[model samples]
Every structure is written in C-alpha cells, then in structure tokens.
Target: MTSCFNEMYLQGAVRPPYARLEGWTRAMPAELRQMKQAEAEALFRRIGITFAVYGEGGDPDRLIPFDMFPRVFSHAEWTRLERGIKQRAQALNAFLVDVYGRGEIVRAGRIPARLVYQNAAYEKSVVGFVPPKGVYSHIVGVDLVRTGPDEFFVLEDNCRTPSGVSYMLENREIMMRMFPDLFRENRILPIDSYSERLRRTLASVAPAKCDREPTVVILTPGHFNSAYYEHSFLADLMGVELVEGQDLFVEGEYVYMRTTEGPRRVDVIYRRLDDAYLDPLCFRPDSMLGVAGLMDVYRSGGVSICSAPGAGVADDKAVYTYVPEMIRFYLGEEPILNNVPTWQCGRDDECRYVLEHLAELVVKEVHGSGGYGMLVGPKSSAAEVEMFRARIKANPGNYIAQPTLALSTTPTFVADGIAPRHVDLRPYCLVGESIDLVPGGLTRVALTDGSLVVNSSQGGGVKDTWVLAE
Candidate 1:
C-alpha cells in the first residue's frame, strides 16, 4: 500500500481521500448489491450504453466495466476546477491559432519551433485555414485529482478525442441502484446533461454557409481502440450518425459521407480518431483509417472538425508547463489551477537537477501515456534507474521528471470490500463560441492495492463523479 501511494504520487495522479471504510463494514446489504448490479445491466440494455471493442476474430461491440459507487465532490472544489479548466482550454485555443496562423509564439521563441515542426502530431495542411467559429478543440477533458482536502493539480489535457463521459453517466446510474440509501442521503451533484452540452458545442462550430440544420457526423476508427463507448454514446445522445473512415469522402471543396441514398454533405465532424488517422491525403499516406482529400475540404471552409488537426501539439506534457504563462500572456489573467512542479529535460540546469534527484523523483516520456515509460523513485532498482538515465540522456527533449506526490485516496469498493484507492477526475469541456464544461466528469481509480496507474488500459477502473448540489 505504501508503494502504491508512493507510485501514485510519482505518476502525478490526484491525491485521494485518506479515509477508507473496508468490506461489509460499510457496505449495504448483499441483496442490495445484487439488485443494483441487475438494475444497472437492465439500464445499460435500455439506454444502449456501449463502446465498440474488437474481440478475437474481428467481432466488435461496446464493452465498458461499470461500477456502482459514485465518487462525491463538493461544489466548492468543483467550481475552482471548472474555472481552471475553462481557462486552460481557452488558452490552448489561443495557442493553436497562433501556431497555425501566425507562428507568433514559435517565432517569438516562447516555444521551440523544432518542437512544433518536428513533433509527429503537428500538421502543415491547415496552416492558412481558419475554423468556422474561429475555434478548434470544441471538446477538452482536463484530468485532475484531489491530493488533499483542497489540493487539486492539473494532470493531462485531452483536447483530441478525450473520452469516458459515458462511463460517468453510466456509473452514476449503477450507483443509484447499488447504494440508493447513501446516494439519496448524500448531496451528489448531477451529471446527466453532459451530452446536451456536447451537442450544443458541436452545433456552435458548424460551417457558416451550412444549412439551418447542419448534418454532423461522429467519425470513428472502427471499434479497435478503447473508449469507443464514449464515441457511440455521444453520437447517440447528439442524434448524429456514427461513421467510420471509409464512409467519408471529399468532393470538390466540400466534405461528404456515403449514406444509403448517396453522398450527403457533412458540415461538422466530431472526429474520434487521432490526427494521423484522420486524413490519409493530409497525414500518413499509408493510413487506411482516413479519407482522402478530407483536409482540403476542411481547409476550404466547407466543413468543420472538432479539435482541428494540429491541436495535439499544444496538449503535450512539455507544452503544459507553459500553460499558466500562456493564460497570462493571452487572457491577461492569473491561472486558476496550479500545475505540479516540472523539470524539462531539454534545459541543462533542469536536466542536472532531475539527474541528481533521480532517487526521489518520477520521470515520464513526454509523448507516452497509460503509465508507460515511467520510473518511480524510492521504488526503482539501481539498474532500472540507470537504464532510465541513459534513455533520458539519449532523448532529453522527450523526457521530464517531477517529485513524487502522495496522491490522496478515497474509499473504493473492491472484492475484499472498501479500501483506499488513488483516484483522479477528468472533467469534460466544450469550447465552441464559448466554453461549456459539464459539472460532473469521469473519476478514474487505480484499482491495485497501492498502484497509482489509473488508465483503463493499465487495468484501472472508473467511478461516477457526483458534484454535490450547491
């Protein structure tokens, strides 16, 4: 358990609640638990809560593990995080505009041009084009966690295809059945209207010349990646068609999709695929997960795409350190949220500092996620640390280090009963003409005894976040 908490802090997960009530000690009746599980399964069938996952032999269906307990947050804490997230999203939008339009920040040396041009994520296709609403990244998910009673730090910014909102809604429904008495008594915040916010944001960025009721499609990568549930869920809730890469095409300056009737004009696309897989003509030429000539149509102002193509460059971990500065530089306001102390390996002084403190710090590869390319101090072997040291020296620009944090813990339900598990919150944001962030978001938990990795791909699970009624 000590090692788990130690790793969690090292990895930058939000500090969890300290108190834990274990087992049947605080659990509801067994019959209640079973009833809740059954009720949740029924609700899943009725509401069609799904994410497409490819099973062996190429079959695909939505699959997400739903939990019955809803993590509760006070309004006071939530409001602060919301303000910070909106500010961050706005600053990122501003940064994207500068990068693609003027290259002002890059030329001014505020950010490295090498980082911009060399990153696999950056694109030259949209350099001169502007979005419909002058906005990119219509949806952003900011990962956060409570490290203490009031200490919540910003983790990652998921501007490109951030998912797991469906889990938030479905988890809450399960909780309602599993712990009805506790839920009723506790002042949990409502998170049912997220899809409404999403729909509004998507509509807000429709093409200026689009018809009164613009046709929006959710572009997907065809059921192999995780978080496919969120893709279909948002599409169903928004009442839009969910399309794969092959279903779309570009004709003239307008983008269109293949329907039963024929090619239909598409004004806005809520794309769930990454940049490289979005348009083969614009990005990786060999990618079959993209439509040819799609970028040209978007560039010509015939269509709008969420999070635009090059938005990922701004969400990089190294780029994150400059966010507060970006907020101040662009918005002329102080940052509402704080970032954990960071060490950029590219800087000589920073690299020296991190190397000296390797025994007490956590290091991460700038581009990797799901807890890969991580080294935890106080837990790493000498051999492991040396290997990481060499890796950092080899690609200093791609590595960063920070002091391990003691992420707070919350009481989580497990097979052994209730125990303290590290947890983090990822609140969703919709940035169109304006910022529209949902009150409740997904609360991911590190399910291992004391392990701090909370990614679903890393065997982590989730809980529904309940923002208490104000």
Candidate 2:
C-alpha cells in the first residue's frame, strides 16, 4: 500500500504551515479537548446547522462532526491554489457558453459531440439563449485532493447547487469563538466576506431589463431539502429573502416574490434546486417545487439565474476528463491544477480494463454526489466488488474509474489523541464579472482510521481551514 502524505509533520518535525498548531495541540489537555468538542457540538445544534440524509431512518437532521484541529496552508501555497481555482472557473463558464451556443469546442474536434448534446443534464431549451454576463455557473465548487506537497488534483467539479460553504464559514466562527488567542497569534485570512462577495456575484449577473439596483433572492426547494439550512443561513447573512417556489410567481415577463407589502420584482435568482425542478412548464411537469413559466421569464431576459438552466453538463464526471483540454481550447492556457487519471467506462477498452481491475480502482457513478453510488475498491469485500462489477457491466456508460489516490492527511483530534487522517478540500469559487474565492476552503477529514472518504454523510468530519497571511 502506498503511504499517505502527512500535512502537519515531516521526518519528526512540523511543517512550516503547521508550526504554530503543534504547540497548541501539545498544550491542550485531554479533558479540555473533550469539553471544547462538546461545546462545539452544542453550538452547532443550537444554530440548527444540520443536514438530512435521504432514505435514512434515523433523525432527519444530524450535526456533522467538527474537528477542532485546523488545516493550515502557507501564503505561497494558497496563492497558487487561488489562481488555479479561478482559472478552472473561467474555463468552465466559457465551456458552458460555447456548448450552448456555437458548440465551437465540439465543432473544432476538441471534445466529443455526443458527450455534450446527448447527456441527460443537457437542456435544449436554452441552446441559443445567452445568459447575462455569459456566465452559466456562478459558483464553482472544485473538489481537490493532494497526493504530495506539489501535487493537487481536481477530484470533481460542482457547477450546479453545491452545498457546504455554510459549514466552512461556521467552522471558522466556532473556532474563533473558542480560541481567541489562536486568532491573534496566527494571522489567518478572513473568510467572513464570503457572503457579501457571493451577493455581489449574484447581483452582477442581473438581467439587462433591470435598470435599478437588482433585488436578489435565493430560491430554495423548501425545508424538506437537505441543504435547507444553508439556504436560510446565506439568506440571513446576505440580507436576502429565502423563498420556496410557492413564495414566488411568474408574471407576463418577469418573476415576482410575494411580500406583505406587494408583489416585488425579483431580478436575480440564486436557485439551490436542480434543473428539473426549476420550471414545471419546461421540465418535470409534476414538480411543485418550481414556478410555472419561470423558464420563459429567464429566457426572455426578465430574470437571471445564478447557474443558468443547462450548466450541469460542464460538471459531469465524463466531461471532467476534458476540462484540461477545455482550458487549452477556450482560454489558450494550461490547466493550473491537474485532473486525476480517469477511465471512461463508456469506451470498450476502458470498460474491459476496469472490469478486469475492479479491486484496484475506485469507481463512481458519473452523476453521483454526497459520497453515494461509489465503490472504494481496497476497502470492499469480494462480494461487494462482484456486485459493482455486475452493475457496471449492465450499464457501462454510467460509471467512471480512477486509480485509488493516496489522499493527503492532516492532524485530527481522535478518540485516543491527535492522529493523521485522510482529507480533501472543496473551494467555492465565485464567478460573475470576475472570478474570485476566499483564501481558505472547507477541509473534510475522514474520522475513521485509514479511511479515504471525507463526506459528511459518510461519517466524515469538517475542520476549519486556515490560509495564513504573509
């Protein structure tokens, strides 16, 4: 088995980024650590910062575990990551506009035509219509995993409604509240401005019809949805209305929000729901979670959507393999961050190779999220492998396989004491008239010993990410 890279320690000495944290961890007593952990959990519960797992019988709302140990990065490291993230965001938005308009990348033989037009997430309704600012995906959540000090690979992209930024902000808030001296000691960058930046990004894409300061509202799929807390949290932070489909209605050309004062015009909608649930008239007619004729209003330039209607195609796992090519084709630049080596099961040779090496590779559904519908090969039993093999053979195009990467680890507070656990980073990059992201991102840690998965639904925990100032 390959050894994982430890982010905090190297050769019995602490890494530069984590030098300050070493003494902090060593000085904390076990009883005090336990008390702080309990206090953190209570705060999370009180704040209602919880998520629900679908098809589960347990409590509908569960608090994601919070690790007190923070993951740190130096200024130089973060500068490189920021550039890569912004570059990827630009390429993704450019790809969305290209694929929906002239299909230039497809016509130029840079990417497969079938992959763009035939995918399930592709919407034909907005083919010729260009969104405001030509930005389809306003918030790009790029999941990154590190294999070594200088090797960071984008695991996947979430161009649609990506959840977890609320956790990123809340984690830092809790940490600052608990350890006041730590904040004074370490010049960690501030991420509190994320909400304001997000609001500005959304407003920057308001439709041309709006001549005044645009009113932006977050469209949520009701409280039953898993990310309901995030929807309300962001609304409160940004001072915008968090409304469900029922709270909105479509007029002749524009959409309006129902308020006690009157029917107020909504200019920009930061929708947190999927495409199929955005407009009942255009998609999924039975969907009560979307407004009727909302698509028409959006297409007619009455209101703008944060991530335009057909943005999902750019984030498909199959399409992810072509992102580097997209950077070259669209931006005429090399990809700053690389993609993990992938094998598309839709191809005959790749499918055969994946079937033969099912136990050595990690396989995931092309559209899967929240850590579901995946097989961690090394951790699975023979029966599990056979089951996945049969599923893959039945539908080859639905799967993609990649080598099980040795994900880097950070110091995490465990049952016995501090230990190294596998971790991953998901930085939410905002795009509008420009592209930018906060210094740090949400760092998820696998709480179980030697586990590679770092999803909250999969028993993983989150840690406050620190990008120290220069």
Candidate 3:
C-alpha cells in the first residue's frame, strides 16, 4: 500500500491508506478524515496558537495556519544536530562578545573592521558594555537543508530574536490528532518543554548585576512583523510581558516598561526588533519603532538583551563559510553539522570564478533575508544574469554565490494530492545554564514546482515537524 511511509508504527487504527488514498478516497471518506480535522481544530483552539489581529483589540485571537501532516526526524539524527548547533552557537556567542569587547578577531584581520562599523546591523552603543553571564546570544534558530542522503547544510543563523518555536509546539499538538494512532503507538520526543526552557534561558542572564529575580520582557516590533504570532506565542508560553517599542522607556540608568500599574523595572529584554530598530538614540535617530536611550541602559548593565546588539555580524553570509574554522578555533571540536558550499565574492579569485559560472550558481545578496534579493542560477533569465553581473562587479562583497543544490523533498498534501516538495527545517535552540532544543522545528515547503525559494514571504507554507521514535 502507498502510505507516506511504512505504517507499522500505527497502532489501533488500520495502516495509513497508502494505496487507496487517491482521488476517490479523499471526499468519500471525508467524515472519517473529519475526525482528524475536528481533532486538530479542537487541539489548536485548546493550545491557543492564536494571533492578535489589529482591528480586533479586545479578544485578539486568530488561529495560526497549520497543516495536519508532520515531518519526522530520528532521535539519533537530532542528537548529532543538537550537539553541532550548540557548539556553533557557543562559538558565535564568543565571537560576538569578543568583537565588541576587544575587537580581537577584527584586529587579527579575520573579519574586516570596516565591515563591522559599516554593517547595517552593527550597534556602536554596545561597544563597552558586557552582557550578563557573558552571553550575547541566548536564543538561536539555525536553518538547515538536506541536499542528499544524510547530507545537511546550514542555510543561515537567526540570532537576533530567532522565532518559530511556538509553531513547533503547536504543530506537535496538531500532529497528535492527524495521526492519533501513530502518535499513541510510536515514540515521539516531546517538545512541550521548549517554553519552559526558554523561560529559564531568559532568566539565566537577568542583569547579573541584580540580586532579585529578574523580570523578562518579550520586546516586539508591534504587530506588522510576519512573526508576530511567534512573538506573542512565546510571550504567552513564557508567561512574560509582551511589550512594543512604545511601551518601554529609559530613565536615568535603568529601563522600565509601561503597564497598568505605572512603570515596572525590566531586568532582561528578549528583543525581537532588528538591531537598528532597538534604540533610535543609538543606531538610527529617525526610527520611530525604537526606544530612545534603550541601548544606554543596556550598556550600563541595568538590563540584559538576549543576543546583545551587533550579533548579526557573525551570521553575515560571508562569515558563515568560516563557521567551521571558528568552531575549531574556539571550541576545539569538529562541527557535527556541515556548511553548504559557498563562494565568497569578497575573494578576487572566487568572484572571477562565480562570474564565469553565472548560469549555474545561486547568487544571493549577503545582507537580505526572507527570500529577497536572490537569483536561482538555473531559473534566472539572461537579463537577470547580466544585471547581477554588473551589480556584483560594482560591489562584489555584497553578494555570495553557491552551487544550485537539490534540497531533499518530503510528501505534502496539495491540490494534486500528495506529492514531493522541497523542504527545509529551522530548529529553535535556547542557550542558558544548558542547551535546550525543541524536538520539532518549522518545516517550510516551497509551494511552487521546482521552486527553491522557501521563505514564507515567497509563498512558502509551514508544516509541523514530528521526530518519530526509531
């Protein structure tokens, strides 16, 4: 029978309808599937994976868009990846602290000092201040793509307010109903502890200068951010106050957040706003979305910011290629996960080589994300290639090129029934007293046929990842 996979793990219920689940089986057994559908909706409601729409001010709850099927990962696979990611984050954290504190790497000429000062994300305000526990990046979401059997590569690192763990939590709940039999029968690693882990991680670095239990706040950029659901979700899960930029103020040496009860001291802030928008006084004076003088208070050690400002430099596309070396240099260990083959445009030789092979490489803007400013080599038109060639020639360092990779595919339900689609996983990790990784991650699928762009902004849908027992 043609099921998604061998259904021997399914208990009680009949094996998944692998063969018969074609055209007629969809609607004819709608009610039977309705049981699964109803259960999912009910679970979602109970879990409250809701988004707060702007117009609806009072009971602002909107259901997160979710799918029934979950992508599964083996425990052994997760163990290896978990170790790799933790080590990678640790190294990056050390790099950020050193970059701003002593400029060791920059002085050593590993990373250009001009690049640091000129980066759109770099914050000069955080130069002298050290973060609590010396942890600059507490939460990190590392994106990974499978190119072939047991071969995975790092797509990017989401260090500044990396989101999507809530979706991971909610997705697990949905999967339980969609495949109740499998969930009950198979051994699935529970991801329910993610929120708690996040709380501990945030709490761990609470203004080490303070003696009391620190109040952690989830700083959001208001509601327009695409990951607003995640911001609110994490806030609710962590039982922390969710504050927008305007809801905060910096007074003298400390930062305070507005609440029904006047102003309350904020010991730690898990800010989701980009570094440029965290403090207008420090970075961009014209920015209305940032708190004035917020960075001053943070630098004074009155409050801790998760992933202290300027952490983005480590995630720079060019710096990504050097992560393995950084891992070895800092951690004295080999990276368990692999990096995708990347061609650095900053290198004169690599730029010439990339230009010659324009039609076969995936050219990308180093600074952009969410699938913006990217050109798939095999899919680009002649005009596009010519435009990129000129753009790269003028500013080679602004771009990076990688060979087109055939990312692994998973079967997903679509208009044409179940079919294989390219997918990638981004797992959220919390670094504190210890490392905690959510068992499942956000599984993004490229909806268009043969389309490699998988950002949600580029019409990608998310699936709940399910790590099944061996």
Model 1 lDDT at residue 285: 92
Q: How well is each residue in 137-165 modelled by candidate 1, as lDDT tens digits?
A: 78888888666666778877877878777
Model 1 regions more than 4 Å off: 1-67, 107-109
- Deviation in angstroms for 125 in model 2? 0.2
Q: Compared with the true structure, what per-residue lDDT tens digits does model 3 show for residues 1-470?
A: 12222221233332232222233235535455556656777887886566543333455565544555456666767777778788888888877788778877777776677666677666676776678777777888899987654677888887777666777777776676566666555677788888888889989988856679989999888876656778888888799999998998988888899989899989988888888788887787788887898877787778888878877877888777777877777677888888888998878999999999999999888887777788888999999999999999999999999988887766665554556677888988787766778776888878677777777556676777766545
Q: Candidate 3: where are CA atoms >4 Å away?
A: 1-65, 107-118
Q: For candidate 2, lDDT tens digit of each residue in 269-351?
A: 99998999999899999999998999999998999987899999999999999999999998999999999999999999999
TM-score-wise, the better of 1 and 3 is: 1
TM-score for all predictions?
Answer: 0.88, 0.99, 0.86
For model 3, how big is the CA root-mean-square deviation? 5.4
Error of 3 at 258 (Å): 2.2
For model 3, what is the error of residue 386's alpha carbon versus the real structure, in angstroms, after optimal superposition?
Answer: 2.3
Query: Could you tell me how far off, in angstroms, the CA of residue 157 lies in candidate 2 after the best superposition?
Result: 0.2
Candidates 1 and 2 compared by TM-score, better number: 2
Clash pairs for candidate 3: 2-18, 2-19, 3-18
Which candidate should be chosen as best, given TM-score against the real structure?
A: 2
Candidate 2 Cα lDDT to native? 0.94
